[model samples]
Target: MADYPILAVVGHPNKGKSSVVSALTQNDQVHISPLSGTTRVAQHFSLKLDGETVFELVDTPGFQRAAKCLAWLRVEELPADQRPARVAEFVEQFRSSGQFFDEVELLKPIVAGAGIIYVVDGSLPYSPEYETEMEILRWTGRPRLALINPIGGDAYVAQWQQALNQYFSLVKQFDPLHASFDQHLQLLRSFGELDSRPGRIFDQAIEQLEQYRRQKLEQAARILVENLYRLLTYQQSSSRLEQAAREQLPELLPAEISRFNQHLNWLERDGQQQLEALFLYHRLESDLARLEVRQSELMDESQWTLWGLEKKQLVLVSAAAGATLGLLADAGLGGSSLFAGAIGGGVLGGVSGWLGLDWFKQQLPAWLQFSAEQHLLGPVKDPNFAFVILGRALSHARAMLARSHADRERLTIHQAGDHFMQSLEMKVQIRLLKQCKQLVRQGPQGQAAEQLRAWIYQQLTA
Candidate 1:
């Protein structure tokens, strides 16, 4: 226990103490409330890697009787070396006293070898009243760091920082709700500086944490890609049923289409949930104001306009894919060059544009197919369906990653710019679009999807 570094976050009532713990641990499940004194006792959070504790953080109750506790300790002129024991004695004596319950709970961790992480609400004015808590922590003689956390808009932080530096060995400003991953990591590394004994352990733990974050991002991308493969190739057909059921195809067909759409929705929702978990978030809220209008809305009018490539980008993608097909056709026709193949693709594309997308969708096999008595709705074979699914996935991933663990803030995507697809290089755009098209039409292309997965991983890290 002595070797394991424990950080006990001690502070005044409602000063974002639990928020700091949540940010550092990346655990949204930590209870947080606006009211003061929400945490009645010290709750230990052992930061772990594969079930092995790397370090510990204790979210302790705010001090309710710091001045009283400090005065009682001063009643005895004990030697400097004996102050820690005196503080522990005060907790022992007051355990049965309800007046100092909060003080006793907060001090238990420090008495048991946890280093102090004193939190102060820097948004408010600095005052001498806080020194009672600071002095108690100093008297314990354990390594200490003071955090000036802004809980509101008006940040009079300079005075808070100056005051904290007087008592604690290290002082820092951290916004528990909005700090970036880098800031969280840097704070953890700073904890290593508090004491020489815990320095190496903190270093090793931070190293593991960095690797873990990267792996989680990759894992999320893998999930998205796998789901996209399924959605693109998804098919729902109705056959081998009673003649009465088959004769009711007029009414039954629309139901099948509705069910297929529902399936896609479920797939997207599942992917979003999986992404949230990979990012270590159990709670997510939508941001209506910041998200692209199309993205924020439901799929009624197909809100993929800002998430997917525009019509021109699609034309280029189609041309590229069609060129590949035409080149093979040309080779079969005994042509030595791809020039004829390129012309063939151009004519094919022009014909498609003239035919309209909906007509092409209807013409594709396995979609609205009919026999003497048998009929089918779809595992939509339209390549555009793949693009639509991919767009939704990308939109969901971007929104989730941007604000997945954000405290008290809703998720949003700024839609002032071009679609995410437009930001990619032409080759990647074409490759992704073509891959989706191929997967939907031919079904489950391992090699193409693997390449797309690698691309997605790169995009996420970048």
Candidate 2:
């Protein structure tokens, strides 16, 4: 057995092949739609099984019967030198021919060396065409397993199973819609049996597969939790600071807070993009598109109408808000002129929002609201104790900004400047620490979360 087992997922047209691929990979890499013939080409995605790279899934387009005359033509005309290209042409012809909904010519990868994961619709009655396809699959001489993908009722499962057993060495019924970690493990185990070259190799492969599954699952969980914490904590902290500024420095708070919030928003969005790349293995462009879709869903129709935000508009708004807020905070608007806090907050917020924090904010306060008297309102409808603390902090920031402007001499401000700066830094650090600690507590017991906590602490200290 090779170190990396290539598993090719193949089945009749509209038999949930892509769904199985998506489920096993835990990735939305392949686009799945209700329309048949979505997958026109084979796609490859690797999965870590056990502690080693032992599993690679190749999602091939759905198989369909070719017309008798067309099949004969393909058999005679498919030249050895141009087989790959000719096969692709034939597949395209069949797809456009309207004689069948799927073209089976894409199964060339499986015929080469990969093990076959033959999927079939369990809901429909077993058809002779499927049997013909299975017989054709057997001709490839690849070790194959049958996966009965249920798209409808289970009433026809017995007949489906009977048909599958005739061709496949192993048969398993799986609902791709609700596939679990254990089910995937079982599927891999069946593939493991295909390799007859006995030794510790099979055992090693199985061990590696199990370890990989566990590790991947843990990684996914960590990513989800980290993103959730980052979004929530960043939003709460930034919102509180903004609200405080609005109340304390009535003259300058609104503009400054707005600027700071915008910067923070950008930081959060950027963080989100990084997170998606790390976990989902998405390119920056695709991740950005996904973020936009999520943001659109989060923004209600009324909000969209008010902002006049198209997809590009939202991205611009988020980016502008982040840059403006970051610059203002760095320049010192409220009191302490700490460039570090301003930059850090802005980056964090912007990245988080970009990644997926738009969804998080929907659960928080509305961006805009009106009172019963038709007066525009900010984040908080009522001023509370937290609001007061936030207000004082903002007032201090404004005064510091004014003093910095008034006194051109840097060192001349001296002790007064030092005190305000130190106090502000301490407050920001404390707030961030508390948030990070809470996030760690929410995570699963693992080295990753511990490492993340340490990283957060180091960032704060730095």
Model 2's lDDT to the true fold?
Answer: 0.49
| Candidate 2, superposed: residue stretches over 4 Å from native | 31-33, 48-53, 66-107, 199-206, 213-248, 262-272, 281-462
- Of candidate 1, the 10-residue stretch with the lowest lDDT total is 334-343
Best by TM-score: 1
Q: What is the per-residue lDDT of model 1 for residues 129-217, given as tens digits with 9 covering 90 to 100?
A: 99888999989988898888877854689988888888987999988877877887898888887876724777887887787777787
lDDT of 2 by residue, 104-223 (tens): 434556645677898888888987776666755665567888898878867788998988898988988987766555677777777778756445444665577566644543453354
- Relative to the true structure, how large is the alpha-carbon lDDT of every model? 0.67, 0.49
Question: In model 1, where do residues sit more than 4 Å from their true spots?
Answer: 96-99, 239-252, 285-302, 325-366, 369-376, 404-406, 413-418, 437-445
Residue 105, candidate 1: C-alpha displacement in angstroms: 1.2
How close is every model to the real structure, measured as TM-score? 0.83, 0.50
How accurate locally is residue 97 in candidate 2, as Cα lDDT from 0 to 100?
Answer: 58
TM-score for candidate 1, residues paired by index: 0.83
